[model samples]
Target: MTQLTDPSGQPPYLRIVAGIRRRIMDGELSPGDRVPSTRQIAKEWGVALATATKALTTLRLEGLVEARPRTGTVVAETAPARPPRRPSPPASPSEQELTLERIVRTAIDIADAEGLSALSMRGVAARLGVAAMSPYRYVPSKDDLVLLMADAAFGDETYPADAPQGWRSRIELGARTLWAVYRRHPWLAQLGSLTRPLLVPNLMVHGEWMLSALDGHGLDPTTLFDIHVLIYSHIQGLAVHLEWEAHAEAATGQSEDQWMDSRADVLRELVDSGRFPTFAKVVGAFDDGYDLRLDALFESGLKALLDGLAPIVES
Candidate 1:
């Protein structure tokens, strides 16, 4: 039980903080264990994203949780002195220092470390060590902030002025580069869809690279753009699972391998039941078990895609 009986009109975020803190105190959520992501908190408690973000932010400030690289937020290894459950106001800072670039950079860091749903304007400001509304000064809303963040993230990589020798090679390079970004920042793939794309300058740099490559290769404008979209879809289609799996792991408190192991009996039953013979045969062949390497999978798919595109480009 999380001590939530208080009748005072305390904000929702403080109650959230207390519940999680109770979890920590009770040993249910141990040191080195992953904490539920902001998305999970929001969904479970029926609070807004900002409220969930604030709760985590308050916990972090109080030393109950610490943001770990590669791993999302986790319980701090050693507890520090208990501070107030509610967050204190951030110390005032000069307003002249804030800039659009700094805001976007901080937002990208948050979205990369945490998932996109974890992102909030207040969260970004907290990360920047400024007033909660500071980010709003430069980026009007969360939506506009996301647009700038996408542009900055995509701008991280660009093609060389002298392009690759062949159109296929250029396309491969472009796809790999984009995949690298998504691999680093999985949240980027979940941005706008293929039909309603984000039309920003930096992202357009990539579009221009691919579009230009497919341009003089005998395909009409529509077909050229369509090929570009197809290649992008290949990356985005698979990239969604990257963040989703991460989110699921954090929320469920189980790694993929751990979760699968828990279902081993079910799997064995399925294998022995004789319904999925081909599945059993293939899985049974791997004594050491199969390793699902997304990197290898991406490379394999990219190669197959380029092979299919070869005839069209070469023609």
Candidate 2:
């Protein structure tokens, strides 16, 4: 293959760095696999030797790759797929020395699997196998713990640089990302009221991205901000229901479909009682469907909103 020079407009190192990350994420490189060497990158990407080295250096600093003496360089094995555990650092004498990261991360896992209501310092401590007071040493209060947890969850997914071109695509990406994150940690959607935001930098970055997507759309500032608020509310409102259903199923050990079936059986009995034929017909028509799928509904509604906004944006 002919050696290619770096594209002129974009920085050579950054372009090279993006190419490597894309390969990793796209599964061209798997966990525990060897990453390309600087020499390999230079040859493959057709960039200068120095540019390739800088690309590798940036990837290493970002925790995407690491170097070993015996092995030249390999993709970092510390990502989530590798299963990182809390550092069982030898018990130190000073209890207060325990890092806040461990405490916050543990709490986040709990809130992720279980709902937010299940989280408490005692619960986090139980999970950590540490004394109840140990968590308090790191996090001052449950509110502080939750705030930190929200930030950590948001930090899980970073926005892709040079996102797809066009304003609508950008807004769709932001909305979809936010919705996915909240869906994963459903409790996060319910944490703060619209009036008082989360005060987390990462969450603010989400808002900033949304605001930028609205730029030059010809919407007034109030309408632009309100549109974002509406989108957030639509996603969060559905997510709360999703969390509620999951919690109900977990407590009762019944799948949502089964629970809905039982409720439908009750409704069928009412339908047979010879009153309200219209209601009976409506309920009977939808008996065999799956339970409410909130994520799908959120995506659908977001798309509809975007469709309605397109004409205005183009105008």
Candidate 3:
């Protein structure tokens, strides 16, 4: 039993489990033979001893191995016997057992893998393997679906009911949580234009929480609500680029770097020609190349915005 090279870089526990499973199925490790001791497995597989132990535990749980007192862990006697496989549960219609709740979840998955722009009622129905008109039972129109999706994503997260020690702390937490939700579903940022505002209760709850955070700042209710929308816009405007980048890559099968490389010569020549000295100088500041770190950009931009708003709060 020599250590095998793992190409996928799977976690050591999974690799170790995979190794043992391969040997058992190959009949190299016979049924009822004493399986390797955790120490022996550790040495042979070059994995940590704890990982080897967990591998054995997984095998035991799967009924492929067992521990016998005074005999150490051995392959289970029933290892070769095939267990009955459970049948998959049947799918239900969107109206029969299907609800708006279930339809929204499926839509979320589509937006998660593909960008939100890729989402359509027909696409969602195709995913459910149902007729295109079927989703209309749960969502009246594509606009309604988008609204439901936004609310669904917003609802998945819980806000801290207890206020932080300070307003700034409270504001930062809410902004960061909202940022995270958008990153999880990048299409969410595009939904913030206030065109009817989705009318979803969960998003309204999020807005309410933000308004409450600013209660003591002396801003009028309208001003406070406007400020919250402005904050959301700032974060979402930058985040929309993330969705664009994703969509571009998926459509063209080109990464950001690859896209830049394709246009590198033309861009470099244009900047270096001295037609735009300030643009050239600024672009040169990033010789190492610019990679978007969404979390860092969100934090820095939010902090700057908050700093700018401090005087407004005091006034």
- Highest lDDT among the candidates is held by which one? 1
My TM-score estimates for the predictions, one after another, are 0.71, 0.65, 0.66
lDDT for each candidate structure: 0.80, 0.74, 0.74
Off by over 4 Å in 3: 1-96, 194-196
lDDT of 3 at 69: 41
Off by over 4 Å in 1: 1-92
Model 3 poorest 10 in a row by lDDT: 81-90
| Candidate 3 C-alpha error for residue 229, in Å | 2.6
- What root-mean-square deviation over C-alphas does model 3 reach? 14.3
Q: Write the per-residue lDDT of candidate 1 for residues 230-297, one digit (tens) a residue.
A: 89998888888898876766565445666677688998999999999999999999976676778888
Off by over 4 Å in 2: 1-97, 269-279
Give a tens-digit lDDT track for model 3, residues 90-116: 365643565678678889987776567
lDDT of the structure predicted as candidate 3: 0.74
The per-prediction CA RMSD against the true structure, in angstroms, equals: 6.8, 18.6, 14.3
Ranking by lDDT: 1, 3, 2
The true-versus-predicted C-alpha distance at residue 245 of model 2, in Å, is 1.1
TM-score of candidate 2 versus the correct structure, residues matched by position = 0.65
